[model samples]
Target: MSAHAMKMLNTLLPALVAVFSASTFAGEAQIELKEGAGRDTVMANCAMCHSIDYIQMNSLFMKRTDWQATVDKMVNVMGAPISQDDISVILDYLTTYYGVE
Candidate 1:
């Protein structure tokens, strides 16, 4: 490689490594979900993109519609790849366990 490219890589590599290492460490910490029906579905689908702690964090204020919108955003905007069957299970789980109504 050229000296300029090597120098650029050397300068940026440490920052990149630090970012990735932090992510790995963050992922090692587990957020326990409530034990109930459809918990498995939430785990299988939601954890693919984000930490499950978000459910608990928002539980205080979230209602059924809020959970529905969040799931819709995940599937439509964020491309979560969840199936229709799993969507119903997840909505049921969230609304029943975490949401208010």
Candidate 2:
């Protein structure tokens, strides 16, 4: 190839690769929760803002009270658009599966 063509290829190829790879790294599949009571409720409500992975990860460190606080924050501070009724169901599921034993 010509010198000018080689120069353009070197510059543009890396830029194109980076633009595509960035999107791949940024987006990820949501982790599916195990089936149990209120699993559907959690999938519908909490996943609206963050991934199920967030709950799974925090479950390692948090207890029922921490999950309660997190859920409260999502609703009260972050405006999660969840209902009080659903809150109870979601809390139950989180505490049961993800909550500290």
Candidate 3:
């Protein structure tokens, strides 16, 4: 209605959008997958078969070979259909970030 009101609405609108955007991406930030694996890769390849918690909870625990085996199992036993490269990426992330001693 008023010019001042319109200006305030414009300013507040952007702030509101920013707040929502930050909140939306906040869930993304919580993801701790390996650097190369990233959120999209994990979601595309892993989320269909398992929960993100399954990945997060194992972080910093499984050994490198164990992680490789797990990925292999997902492909061979669980029928995840992931490519060898993707498997490698996922294993690399898990081992580097969460591998056990």
Candidate 4:
């Protein structure tokens, strides 16, 4: 290749590699929620907006009330597109499985 072309490639190659490399965040994980009846509802609706790991992260400290407030925020403020029936089921699943004792 011409020297000019080689120079352009060297300039752009590192940026291209950085942009395309999967290893940067490849270790990102998904949450494995506790299995139950409403688990599917929660996964279906909640995961549409954010990762299940969001719930798993909060499951460490959040309680039933906290989950309730979170759901309220998602629905009322963030517009998560949850239905009334799905809301009830998702709340139940999150509280029962992820809530702190």
Candidate 5:
């Protein structure tokens, strides 16, 4: 192959690799939750102590008060140490999307 052609191939190869890598990472940036999947943040933050599925499934049948109580327990009893902003987001998600239906 010509020297110029080899040089072009090397440059193009790196560009192609970078493009593909960026595209792959774009898809993996973050998992976007639906309106009701607010508990996802909770799971991400609180799952250190237990299974996230346990929280997800249980929240499905809870009332707003139940959710508040559960959040309180996680903060006060379990000592999950979540931020107030995150706590509000999680509680809103549970009450709006995961509450008893």
Candidate 6:
């Protein structure tokens, strides 16, 4: 190859490797949520906007009211298309499985 071609390959190769490596790592970093009655609904709805890992991260301190407020914010403020029925199930699951006192 020409020297110019070699130099371009050297410049782009690291960037290409980094991009692929990051994507591979991200794909493998999924959070497996605890199984529950509303697990499927929460997975389907919540993951539409943010990582489901947020639930696990906050479970240590979140209460029923906190989950309710968060869901309200998601619906009223963020325009998440969660049906009323799904909201009830999701709240129940979150509060029962993840809530604190």
Cα lDDT, all candidates: 0.92, 0.86, 0.75, 0.85, 0.74, 0.92
Instruction: Give the C-alpha lDDT of model 4.
Output: 0.85
Candidate 2 global TM-score: 0.71
Per TM-score, the best of the predicted structures is: 1
| Every model's TM-score | 0.75, 0.71, 0.58, 0.72, 0.55, 0.73
Clashing pairs in 5: none
Candidate 3 or 4, higher lDDT?
4
Clashes of 6: 0
Candidate 3 lDDT for residue 60: 54
lDDT of 3 at 79: 89
lDDT of 5 by residue, 1-101 (tens): 99999999998999999999898667545533444555567667666676455555776679988988988998899898888889888888877866785
Please provide, for model 6 over 5-98, each residue's C-alpha lDDT reduced to its tens digit, 9 standing for 90 to 100: 9999999999999999898659648778789799999989998888777888899999999999999999999999999999999999999999
Q: lDDT score, residue 96, model 3?
A: 61
Q: What local lDDT score does residue 10 receive in model 2, on the 0 to 100 scale?
A: 100
- Candidate 1 lDDT over residue span 15-98, tens digit each: 999999898768657668889999999999998898788899999999989999999999999989999999999999999999
lDDT of 3 by residue, 40-90 (tens): 666688888766767778765679887788888888998898987777767
Model 3 RMSD to the real structure? 9.4
Clashes of each: 0, 0, 2, 0, 0, 0
Model 6 misplaced regions, further than 4 Å: 1-28
The positional error of residue 38 in candidate 2, measured at the CA in angstroms, is 0.4
Over the stretch 1-101, how does candidate 4's per-residue lDDT look in tens digits?
A: 99999999999999989876655335334337789989889878987887687888898999888998999999999988999999889878988888898
Model 4 clash pairs are none
